[model samples]
Target: MAATEQQHERALEIFLDERPELRIELDHLNPLLAQAKGETAAQYRAERLHEAFEAEAERLGLFAWELTLQLTAASPQDYQAQRLEVHKEVAEMAGMTWADYCQLHDL
Candidate 1:
């Protein structure tokens, strides 16, 4: 079934509850959001969310996109597969084996 706006909002609410510290960032960004209109608001919010995720990923010693995938995956298996795939791609790009890359990153 397709998710509803209310469901999305509830999911966001639950996510915020689990990560109260992010609320401060959200609060800080809300004024910017208020000033934006329509698509601009959506884009601005997406950028801010990406920035927030990037910051958190840095803190956690992970790539921002990787953290995003990890957090947003529909299931544990999905996350695992995506995580491995991303790592493998990154490792190939870096001219390293997956095992070596993981070891270097302490993953």
Candidate 2:
């Protein structure tokens, strides 16, 4: 099953709890990590964290959404399945067979 919003939030909480330094790095990288009206500190931090992840993903020549999926997936197998499903959808949109698309992208 796809990850829910609660799961994503929990994952982020756990990730941050495990890596306090990452929060500092994200805050440093994203100067706009300030709380908005009606937004909690956690919410602002989560938003900045996402922005930081997006920047990092772009720097690494990776898709931000895919990176998010990888980060939030329940397991490696789940991530692979979700990733393959995404590729299959993209292949369909591009009017290419899965095998051809996979080969073209070295998947």
Candidate 3:
């Protein structure tokens, strides 16, 4: 009955299949979105890298759980549990936790 069971299996597989890690280049990131006036290509590149990283991480984190909707409408608790599990998996897959990453980058 739960979406996390068999019915969600295939979609989960496909989504995982689609999200591959990318090598990032983030030299210029701030001015583009925040300061529209002085935003140069360098900033654009950084912004793009940031956006890409966000999207890739989201997908990899099993936010694609909508694929599991065919199985059931998961409760908030189920979704939260799954999200945490997915976040952990995603962070590990990408080589760090959110905390470790933020701290490492001094973010």
lDDT string, candidate 3, 1-107, tens digits: 22455645554444344543332234333454645655776656545654554475467553334335422335767655654565556567888978985575343
TM-score, every prediction: 0.54, 0.57, 0.32
Per-residue alpha-carbon lDDT of candidate 2 for residues 8-100, written as tens digits (9 for 90 to 100): 566566556667788677556433435434566656666777776677668877666566667778899988898788778889989999889
The best candidate in terms of TM-score: 2
Better of 2 and 3 by lDDT: 2
| Model 1, span 1-103: residue lDDT tens | 2233554455455556677777666656655554655445556665665566568679988665555555666888986787777777778988998789999
* CA lDDT of every candidate: 0.65, 0.70, 0.50
lDDT value for candidate 1? 0.65
User: Which prediction has more favorable lDDT, 1 or 2?
Assistant: 2
Ranking by TM-score: 2, 1, 3
Which pairs in model 3 have colliding backbones? 28-46
